[model samples]
Target chain A: DAGITQSPRHKVTETGTPVTLRCHQTENHRYMYWYRQDPGHGLRLIHYSYGVKDTDKGEVSDGYSVSRSKTEDFLLTLESATSSQTSVYFCAIRTSDRSTDTQYFGPGTRLTVL
Target chain B: SQQGEEDPQALSIQEGENATMNCSYKTSINNLQWYRQNSGRGLVHLILIRSNEREKHSGRLRVTLDTSKKSSSLLITASRAADTASYFCATEPTGPGNTGKLIFGQGTTLQVKP
Candidate 1:
């Protein structure tokens, strides 16, 4: 609802295969984030980009990587997908002004690894 | 480890009744936020209460923060069937380079019976 969109809304891949989820935002926000949602864990941050070419790891970044080439695009990639990496992924963005702490989210991408 | 833990893993209420969800966090935070997720969709920002703020309101939602107890509560009045969703509490840790990185709770699933 925040002018955000995720590519391949749903994806299925075999174990050891590679998967990439894309997030695009039209709002020109400076901060973008990647997160995964699980039943008992709720949501955990995977990776985030504070600015183009600047990224950082999150709580669960072990198996995931992210790249932000431009202001509108952020990508999350799994080099070797595994059953443990199967989860619903979300992308969020916020303005850099720090006027408000609210983060807007994209529709999400559901990935299944066999 | 999750910074916040929500009480009453699930809640059910009549459409017209009020619903309250509580969240407790272990660390000091700069701000606490509430988000809602419907089924398999991404999270939607509901409201945010800063550490210095006691209470804030938006539409039918009211949030209160008690830094002394390191907890927060969200109250939704005049609930509707459409309000059925999972609510999560996230905290922005008070530290350096915290560019809106949030640690989330397990969430409370709310069902509003029509």
Candidate 2:
């Protein structure tokens, strides 16, 4: 479990609506990541934060934004949801402060846009 | 768009048989890591092999990295039904000021028959 939890385990929303997914970790990990898993595409990074208020875009960051106001929480927001944005979202945390990076993931949020 | 590509998009084997998955990357890397995702759940980190290391083992899992060939492989010995899941390989490139960003592969769907 790694003490990571994601909110809204499942959600169904209409296109053009705004959606926000929350990730909370009790481990006080330095790095947090948001990723989406889609069929055939596997998992693609959307956004990540190295520390509080230090977020960066990932490969698929066009329609998504993220925020981290505290070390324990990271939020991923879709300004305007689209059909293509429907996917299972995962939040990961890097447990290592050393050179080697190993990420532990949360349970995930399954979002569907219609 | 993806740095790593896994071979045999899908695999099926008996519980006692060994399952092997191969991953090939496009460029030089700092490390190669493997992850497993059960259906409808988040990914779980399995093993990681740095570019400097050839092989590493954890329990029944063995990971080998070939930086010269820009490839890696994951071997699960005496596979069990619980081993059935999707496996993905991710790469982190080497350089100064590295963000430790990981580019993931398409992944391989592994099925172990009981």
Best by lDDT: 1
Q: Give TM-score values for chain A, per-prediction.
A: 0.95, 0.96
lDDT of 2 at A100: 51
For each candidate, report what fraction of the true interface contacts it reproduces.
0.95, 0.71
Q: Candidate 1's residue-wise lDDT over B6-94, tens digit each?
A: 98899999999999999999998999999999987888888888899999999999999999999999999999999999999999999
State which candidate has the highest DockQ.
1
Candidate 1 chain A weakest ten by summed lDDT: A94-103
Measured against the true two-chain complex, the DockQ scores of the candidates, in the order shown, are: 0.90, 0.77
lDDT of 2 by residue, A1-114 (tens): 789999999999999999999999998988899989888888888999999999988899999999999999999999999999999999999876465578899999999999
For model 2 the TM-score comes to 0.96
Score each candidate by Cα lDDT.
0.93, 0.92
Error of 2 at A10 (Å): 0.7
List runs of model 2 lying over 4 Å from the truth.
A97-100
